[model samples]
Target: MKEDSVLKKLSRDWRVVLMVALVIFSVIAIGPHFDENGQFATNLQYGLDLQEGSWLQMEFQAEVVTVQTGQPLQEIAANLSEQLDAEVLPVGPDQIEVRMPMTEAELRPLFEQAGAEVVAVNQGVSKETAESVKRVLDEKVNSLGTKDARVNVLTGLNGITRYVRVELAGVDMETANEIVGKQGKFEIRVETTGDQTQHVLFGDSITSVSTPEKDPHYGKWGVSFTIDEAGAKAFQEAAISSNAVNDPQNHELIMYLDNETVYSAPLTVELANSLKANPVRSLTATTGTGDEGLEKAMNLEIHLRAGSLPVDVKVVGSGSVSAALGDYFKILSFLAAVLALIVVGVVIYYRYREPSIVLPMVMTTLAEILILLGIARFIQQLDLASIAGIIAVMGTGIDQLVVITDEVLHEGRVPSPSVYLKRLGRALGIIMVAASTTIIAMLPLALMDLSTLRGFAIITILGVFVGVLITRPAYGKIIMAILSK
Candidate 1:
């Protein structure tokens, strides 16, 4: 009868029930299981410092400039490109991107000569260009069949992105460097008779590559690209010399990247005739129609760029961690967490001198940490900094539990149920205020890309939320049941 009453009581309390459900769900999400080698493991991922990996930080060698001009923006950009001997693109109505590194002082004179004034100059690429660079890097890394990689564009508050960082797990520093530094060599060749081919131009001759789009009239997916004047003339000459204009079926154009043929198609009748009369600067390579065509066209676009960034990048920093060292760090992290919990339990026991109070407090805190880890398994990878945050959370959690225990056990004895309820409310109010302050303090660190601190801030914030919303309230109800008994 007493066991039944206890079960009924637990069922009556929604807080206790919710906590029980969450704990079960957390255990499942963690997915602890035996590996093929009969070793115990969970679905938890570790970051660079806690796993074998290599990291690289690269700085973009480009500039974003604010300009004031009376002439048309395109005309000013063209003139500036000519004088500076570099690529210039308009990013906004007043903001232009200079592909080459230049200081404000150096750019001012050039802007004036081009009928424009340099209002401001920042040493980085614009946000759009930075995103493009990130995309290209992501594609390059994924092409290597790397399962674990992270690419981040670090942007400043002024909207200029200055650096990009890449982290790859299970890779050595040398291989990582080679992957980032390598560039694909793209070439176009015209087929003469049989298997004979003549070189037309290289990737350097290509000025720009556009995203894949469908031709509305033909319902075909293709990427459009523009070539320089010299490339256009060379392409026209190659076509005429190969007699591709008159015998389109017999002659074909092949595109190669790194000496491997990626695309081969006979020139269209219209394109052949046009090349005979004039040099074509703009050309389209159609993949085909429907979803498969769109996918192929996207790949072709990446091939056209040849793994090149719009802005140049210089490796600013590089590092690697060996697997043995990473194992040591992981062991240290686990020891730290265990040591922290032991310390908290000892300190709380010294204050209360009661096993009931100390055990529940420690167990509740552990539950909070478990839920945090379970959620992080899906969203984040644990690192040294995040582990530190978890330890800090344990400390804070014990403090809050102390507040609750002292409040409810006022006058050294369990109070009436009504008084216990009032004290619990007051204790929760205190916890809410403290949690809000901690969250607010960590907000900037979490939101801003402060490098390593970002992970710490985010983990701390998540811990606080889990404690306040889940474990703390459940602890309160469980303590009430224990004390009333």
Candidate 2:
């Protein structure tokens, strides 16, 4: 009857119920199952160490500099671009991101000539440009239909990105090289006589490309883009020479990306007439109405840039892992995790010499791991370092649980309910302070762009929180119930 009452009491306790519910939810999230090939699988994602993959770390061939100019920042960027014969993007009120690697000495003269003072120079691109490069790489990877890929921009404390890392799972080194190196060649050509076409401009001439937007007037989907002055002149000349402006239907304008025809349509009557008058810098390539058109328009927007990154990049480091090696690492990582749990359980059992107390500690620690993994499944991919972190968390979790056990069992006698509550509160207070210290120490690693240690730091911090907030508190309650009897 006492045991039944204890069970009923724990069931009613919100902390115990929450812990049980979270464990069930975590199991579902992990979803341990077997594939058609009889291989075990789960929703958890593994990093390069446990997967056959290639990783490339590329450095952007760009420089971020602080410039102080009496002229407007945008105008300084434009003038610097023209003077240096490279792309210059404005980053801040006094910062210009030059898309070419130039040293301080090489840039000082140019800045002086442009009526701007070079305040400071750094060897990287702005965060925005880094993100743009990442976006382009993501598009390229998606186009190739890679199953799993990750692109990360490694920024520094100064808020400049010097390197970007690419990881592609189940891909060989050579193929990975090709994928990152390949860039689409986008061309605009006008049909002259029957099928013969004359080139008007290349993707380099494109100044800006916009997202697919529905035309308010016609309800058609289109991508609006702007070209430079030179490109506008070339486009107009091609239209006139090809007689496209006169015979808009027969003389069609075709857009090609990597030699594959993407958009082929005659010049619109209005556009043809306008081109006959003068060069038009702004143009819109319209697709037909509805879902298909919207999809095509989105694709057209991607092709318009021709896979051009805002700044060039050079591969600084690269590595590949074979399937056999990855499998070996995976096995070792699994064994390490299991060994950690076993060692922790044995140590706890030895310390308490009581199954009731030791079992709850081990079980509570396991619950913390499950909850961490469940949350990680959706947010972070586990790597070898992450496994190490899990082990570390297991150790820390046991330490905290032991603290609770020792505090509750002070003087080797069952305390009254009021005393138990006070002890539990004191134990939790210690755990919270320890957890705070761990979190504070790990904050830099978690927030900084250190790709390798990020997973480890994040998982450790999460485990600390789970222990302090959920599992440890519930364990205290359950142990009190058992001791009270």
Candidate 3:
């Protein structure tokens, strides 16, 4: 058969054979389902936003004595840390400290309130005990498979008492409470000491949250509001009758963060409409319990409740890789490539009289492109440098393929096809010189800090490499056969 004879002639070239082999090899390297943790093995790295983790803020009870021992500062810190079994950061030489979350169960409730004393906290670490908390944090980091993260410790002062602060960056809301600044559980039964027992309630009942303009003249960050409709009327009555006692101390609505009076101020503004009409001019609204008793309504049982904080964060720095830019870069690279191809194609066509001789190398150039992209997606971040490398590799492939085309098909220079191999040797020498110069030119980008530009340079150097070494020879072998045809 005439077709069988032509196919048999083409089959003699090993280039076609090797190209098929590399394709099969690449498929095996990146195919199939991967486990969650095993996804790391697939060479697709995710950014921090893509990863799931947590941010935490723990607050400690201000005035609490755990042990009866009247020990010195160092002894107290050591004993406290030992009790919690986590990291304990002390505020000063005298008082105040913190307990970072170390375990899932470190914040569970333990006991219930009794006849006006207080309840006990259950199976969780307290500032009284927790020494190896830092180790737990380290283990958590290692499990994430990332080296990038942020941590900070701070102290808050009020001219009266100092409070401890801790901050960990780049975490989602859900995981934050685990690293609570304290064992954020307080259950105190009250009798108001020698005078009248202070109103003790949960901090979890803040019906509304807002930054209100309490005083336009005193420009400062502040939040003000009235309770829900039902609670508002009751709070109004309590403030009206108690308005005469106006002694700042007794009239003060003491606010606490886990049982510490962070704020204690006298009832000032009186909302009269709140008492009669459930004023919907309501600065804000919150769903409230039906309790209309003055004490019960005003006792806003609330806790900061591991709520989201007001810490402002912004993406001040970022690197974006636009596919549009990629396409434009690709087009630019393509133009340069097309220009290079035209120069080589012109020289080769002038030299090789047969069109059949030039066609196979053109096909080989396309194959080079597939191989370059496949490798880039496998090994490194597919950035601009990789694109540059791909373009460079494509150009070299065509250039060398042109060389093979000329040497093997030029009827004026050769009588036997065997002599054509010698021309390939000289062509390879020329490729080496060109590739070396390109690689040297790309070296500066590798050392530079331009995040966007580095990827381009990296790809360029690698492309020149593959072109000079493996691809050139493979292409040379294939086109050598195509030219012989």
Cα error, candidate 1, residue 179 (Å) = 2.4
Instruction: State, as a TM-score between 0 and 1, how close model 3 is to the true structure.
Output: 0.38
lDDT per residue as tens, model 1, 332-421: 999999999998899889988888788889989888888898888887778899999999999999889889988999989899989999
Better of 2 and 3 by TM-score: 2
What stretches of model 2 exceed 4 Å from their correct place? 184-276, 282-303
Please list the residue runs of candidate 3 whose C-alpha ends up more than 4 Å from where it truly belongs after superposition: 1-16, 27-316, 319-354, 409-414, 447-451
**Residues 301-420, candidate 3, lDDT per residue (tens digit)?**
222221222111212222233334435554565486677666755665676656665555655665555555456655545433454555666666676666655555566543355566
Ranking by TM-score: 2, 1, 3
Locate the minimum summed-lDDT window of 10 residues in model 1.
1-10
Residues 336-437 of candidate 2 have per-residue lDDT tens digits of 889998888898888878898888888898899999999888888788888889999999998999999999899988899999999999999999999999
Error of 2 at 376 (Å): 0.9
For each of the candidates, give the backbone clash count: 0, 0, 35
lDDT of 3 at 418: 59
